[model samples]
Target: MENSTIVPKSSLDFLTQLKENNNKPWFETNKPKYLIELNHIENFAGALLHELSKTDVLETASGKKSVYRIYRDIRFSKDKTPFKTFWGGSYTRATKERRGGYYFHIEAGNSFFAGGFWGPNAADLKRIRTEFAHDTEPMQKILSSKSFVSNFGTLQGEQLKTAPKGFDVNHEAIDLLRYKQFLVIKRFTDDEVLSPNFLEQALETFKNMRPFFDYMSEVLTTDINGASVL
Candidate 1:
């Protein structure tokens, strides 16, 4: 209910202007405004972290720590835009026991909440594929649940056009096994992002991801014998 938790219209306006004028000169002139908006976003991230900690453990120390830098790393990119057009951040769950992560992106028309394994290592990918190949029912049930469907629509991520080396193309769980990354996403409209209850709504969306996260955590932390790896 705090004012800091609310996304101010001015903040969004500033981002919109930044997108139109992405040059360093324009940004330098408006640096003060940018800093003010960043503070609001940091407060929102901090408050979200506080609420999230009540239900889950996080390794992120503070809201500021969770926020991604506004400056884009363009060393390897063709688009040499010096500043990012949006504000984004992520939260990593605490310990090796808790797998997966949480992310939020705030932009004029692209606001979204996303969480899951963006890039699984070779070992973890193989293990996950093995589990799906053995039995897809558990993961299938979670993905097919009403809450999951309502929130994320469907499982999403990069996938191999053909099955991975060890997985059969015709395997029963091949659809899931082909995935190289596991992710779920929920988008929000500008109206929704600027709403008073946006913070609470964001928390609810994160909470809804628990079943999928818990399932992956179990798979990643154990061997075939179901013993802890960590």
Candidate 2:
């Protein structure tokens, strides 16, 4: 970091060290260190929000509103760790409706930023698939764009083995229609985050991927503003 970075070396060190000692006793003893790291993450989220606001409207883009808690929900998980070994956050709309959003994860060696809606419910999934059936061109353009592909590689997450219900097997966009989740991600090394130009890289990554997010946002948006036919 030339001057200073929101996420410094110590933040990464804290998380990496925590992985070895992931018990309450260790955590209780090192709570101050954890809080400092968490604060750094919060500041980083705020900085990202500022960058995104220039291109898009992040309705709920504050640190407190967007940062995720470190506490793990081990209710039904196999690895029942008491806390997380990473610091994370999101920049998204305030509404409960499913839509595209931004995510940031900072761990020891696994720093990354991911965007797009993940695992929408049955109804939302139906809506997205229905939109694809009507006109695949819009999403196709986004998927095939040079910048989009370069940044995110391709749409990711689980996909169905066959065509989804209500969509024909022989449909023109059958390949895309088989997708159950619409997501993309960009990974970074710990050194990358610690670089002097990390913030610039972060902003550019988000900007490059904004078009895809906008496309998915349009797909999931449900507004009933038209005059009632009835």
Candidate 3:
């Protein structure tokens, strides 16, 4: 796979293979191919992150951290994938833990790249929900923007104060379980509508919303929104 330019076809397939053959021995067998794919995925994700940051709409979180971790935890799940082929995006500032960033998942006619809170664990989700509550007005305003609507469809602001139907938001061990990452997971149908140029337009829209995140970061720290909360 290293010398080949196309690389492996499906990320799901790679994961499935890893899960099928459990044990260090199996991993060692596929180590070379896995490393190559991992490198490719990292390069692509890094490029996308850099591109978004250059626009001033998004800022890459920095500091001592890891990029493109290929480890997979399948302890509870019946299906196990030893490693992941695709690299998800993440960012953090100096000395800060890599809590939230950006991630792009591509699927057949269902491609979406998410920004905002990307925490898969409990504490991160709580903090994001709290932030959302504190800055609900501005968050809604950003959601209502023409750009956001055009790309992701209408969004409803759900307060984290209440527990979701299947989720135990109040469970003592709730913080231990992984939760959805983004406060907002903008979804787009992979149709004729989602061309390269269309994605570029969406990126610009997200860039436009970057100020909202910066504003919310401050507002979350200080419960005051100055004059206009929105």
Question: What's model 2's overall lDDT?
Answer: 0.79
* lDDT minimum window of 10 residues, candidate 1: 1-10
Clashes of each: 0, 0, 5
Q: Write the per-residue lDDT of candidate 1 for residues 78-183, one digit (tens) a residue.
A: 9998999899999999999999999999999899999999989999998888888888999999999999999999999999999899778999888898899999
Clashing pairs in 1: none
Cand. 1 Cα-lDDT: 0.94
Winning model by lDDT:
1
Candidate 1 ranges beyond 4 A from true positions: none
In order, what lDDT does every prediction score?
0.94, 0.79, 0.49
The runs of at least 3 residues in candidate 3 whose Cα sits more than 4 Å from the true structure, single-residue gaps closed, are 1-24, 57-66, 74-81, 84-86, 93-100, 105-111, 118-137, 154-182, 187-211, 225-230
RMSD of each: 1.1, 3.3, 8.1
* lDDT by residue for model 2 (1-230), tens: 32333568888899888899888899999999888777777777777787778877678647667788888899999998888988888887545433577788888889888887686889778877887888889889988999888888888878999999878999999988898877888999989988868888888887887777666656667522322222
